[model samples]
Target: MENEWKIDASESDVLIKSRRSLIDYMSGSKNNFKGHIAIQNNEVENASIEFSLKVNDKDSNSDLKLIDFFENDETPVIQFKSTSFQKVNKSINFLKGNLTIQNITKVVELDAEFIGYRDYNGTKNASFEIIGNINPKDFGLYYNSYSSHNGYAVGSDIKLIANLEFKNQ
Candidate 1:
């Protein structure tokens, strides 16, 4: 599998699967949430990967938004933020006199670090699984009835699925 057109990922290519609840919020709404660099070219090592992964708002569609949080100061310690759909959603009740709560779709970004680098293989592609939250309120979604409940609007969870081909060049 290491012939080189595409490389398969080994156990080491997984990097680390981290759950970052906090990001800029504007930059986490993307499908290609992460990036990778081939550490080997023609079986020789030569590349570094810099990437960021966007958590799922669950929709897996065009109705996604992101917020970005960048580092502004230099410190030996690292700090990150965490948030959920509740931050952007509106609650709706059918009691005749209630605030209109709309659902918000919020895409969160996760942090991943490459654990190690290795050679390439057609069967050795890197795969990632990210977890995050989405709020319909941020996107302004509402339910027609609160009593009926529609049965589907129970939770705000998102997921991301990807098939990556690693090429060492």
Candidate 2:
């Protein structure tokens, strides 16, 4: 329990956002996933996360994207493994990791901030907020449907935002 933390799925969230050419319609997914974080002496040492974004999930509004855009059947789970961690300020930090999506792995940087550790009902919890953006093309999601007066049907960049909580274990 000294150097390891278990993800509290009940208290965590993974949200992705992207827009389409039509100003009114936006494509995105709000997922609840599980993962772990390893720390030593208050410094991040390692981290790993795995999550399956099922199109049928209640929070998923883009079923067409799951089949045509991402092809979730071939690659069910999206994963990330941390390679390095850097502290930019007292609360802000950087996580360098490889994100594997649809069998394509790319190195990505995640901006993370420590939300402080506190004891809640006798349980010690550490929380963090991470944000980043990735190009869908990098992960083989290159399908594009252009509109006449507008731009491409879908945006190229997908923004990822996560709020995660881990319990000392």
Candidate 3:
């Protein structure tokens, strides 16, 4: 049987940082996501990856502004599924996937890196980092406003970074 890996959601962290050049400027992040990855030959092998985030679970250490960023009542969940994986090296890789937001799915690419493995407590674990950028407008999460300081209320790109750990369970 092939080995399967699962994300240690309790120990892993997914932080999504978004920025806006509004009149006063705005930037924040949300940490909390569930993800999994398939491994082969000590590297990511195929497209058996999945990630999900609950809109209502977003936190920015201030007000709950993410709720309005997403239509939680209609699309409570944001999802991502891998379509393919390309290994660049032992430490670097690329994942082509689909990200679904508010029922809209768009093709996206994420840069991944294997940060090596470790023995935490009594269990073996693997660590990785994934980074990507997306245009919120592509997912129907557009915030348009003519900024007096600049051009638009928010930039077209939103950056997402996740430092994930998988337990050999």
Candidate 4:
């Protein structure tokens, strides 16, 4: 039997990291996201997630500039819908999904780890860590020419790490 689980937003987090140089990077996190997963026999059957594309970086100026790169006013949300899940082991799985950003959708493969289940306050909860990399240019996010000159060019790839907790529903 497949069981449905709703994400516990308060206990989940999505982190974003973008490198501007070899040693310089900006990181931010988001806790406001909605998602659900269907699991059968301890394996994920399907999953989908959606969240606004806001990066709460520590530096206000950097945050604003990053948001502009994403054209947030025009396309404000990022969405993912799983198409397949391939179990690699008891704990690791490869989740292939369609990721939509800036009105462009691309197929991406994410590394998902099943962190097991816990009974918290009489409710069954599951935890997972999903990680992936994406190129901003692929989503039509181009780096500013001024910022690219010298040694300030932002890296092409952005790293995404999601720590998700879901409650049985």
Candidate 5:
């Protein structure tokens, strides 16, 4: 899809926005996410896809965050239950709850959503980012090395990778 589209960053952006936090001790809230898509023949409509997310992380927070985002559509979408549904209303509710993580250090897949064709610039390249809040309870470290919040994230170190493809029809 080549429409000069850009994923406008939001305080609620679904992806992580800072890599410094992954290691910086002074880092505050954190976010981590990943995605991939492919188009063949023409393009897959967001209304007709059933995307699947496979998230992994050494920190328990990452796993929990991924789960939070994987919410089902409350309202009926199209004539089925898939991520590719073009119904915007059917998706708004679900997208809002997209998961979140805390103190993630290990590598893991974030998510995969089915989608209808939406003109993705031109080719389905692996595009990605991460930004959001992360809890400290999951991490083995604490603020100022304090004992009260020892369960927070430890040695922050995060990475993200996105992948997409275009196949000839």
Candidate 6:
């Protein structure tokens, strides 16, 4: 049997993390996103997800400097479209996908954990946790020379984390 699931945005959360220094870090989160999963015979056949973060959104916790760093005006959205899923175990999988930032697309792999399913209010729901790391420089999100010279350089790795819930459609 084939089944399709849509993200329950109200129950899902996405977060981003980055290091500003050896001991200092920054983090932000967003609740608004859209995604879907396709399953056949209890296995994920494919999936896709997309979300946008506003550099000036207070709730997003985006640093003011990011306004120019991310070029939010020209490219306001970040998106991910899964190309394949590789199962490593019963509960663990690697989701290979294309991640687009600032109109630049790069292939990335994310660790996905299937947290199983549940019956809630006569509906079937599923949960998952996805994590990935990306280098901001790869997408041209480099800090100015001044920041680097002053030892305020941001770490190359930015972690993307998601706790997602899906409801069967």
Q: All candidates' TM-scores?
A: 0.29, 0.68, 0.73, 0.69, 0.23, 0.71
Candidate 5 lDDT, 1-169, residue by residue in tens: 5222222112112233123322221111222212222332333223111112233223534312322222342321111112322223421212112222332342222333323333345644323222223343333322432233344443343332222222222
Model 2 / residue 114 / CA error / Å = 0.7
lDDT of 1 by residue, 1-169 (tens): 3333232232221111113221112122232222333333323222222223433233333222221111231211111222311111111101111111122123344432223333455334433222223343444432222244332222332222222345343
Candidate 2 global lDDT: 0.65
Please give the TM-score that candidate 6 achieves against the real structure. 0.71
For candidate 2, report its TM-score. Answer: 0.68
Worst 10 residues of 1 by lDDT: 92-101
Clashing pairs in 4: none
Give the winner by lDDT: 1 or 3. Answer: 3
**lDDT per residue as tens, model 6, 1-169:** 8889998877776666556533111222343567887767777756676555443334433442444456436535567777777877666788888888777899999998877788778888888778998888888776563464454556568777777778899
RMSD of each: 16.8, 5.2, 5.2, 4.6, 13.6, 4.6
Backbone clashes, each candidate: 36, 0, 0, 0, 49, 0
Candidates, ranked, TM-score: 3, 6, 4, 2, 1, 5
lDDT of 2 by residue, 1-169 (tens): 3478887777776666566422121122344466677776776655665444433343344423434564436534456666777776566788888888777899999998877687878899988777898887888875554643234455678777777788887
Q: Which ten residues in a row have the lowest lDDT in candidate 4?
A: 22-31
Q: What is the lDDT of residue 129 in candidate 1?
A: 29
lDDT against the true structure, per candidate, is 0.27, 0.65, 0.65, 0.69, 0.27, 0.68
lDDT of 3: 0.65
Which predicted model would earn the best TM-score? 3
Worst 10 residues of 5 by lDDT: 73-82
Candidate 4 accuracy as TM-score: 0.69
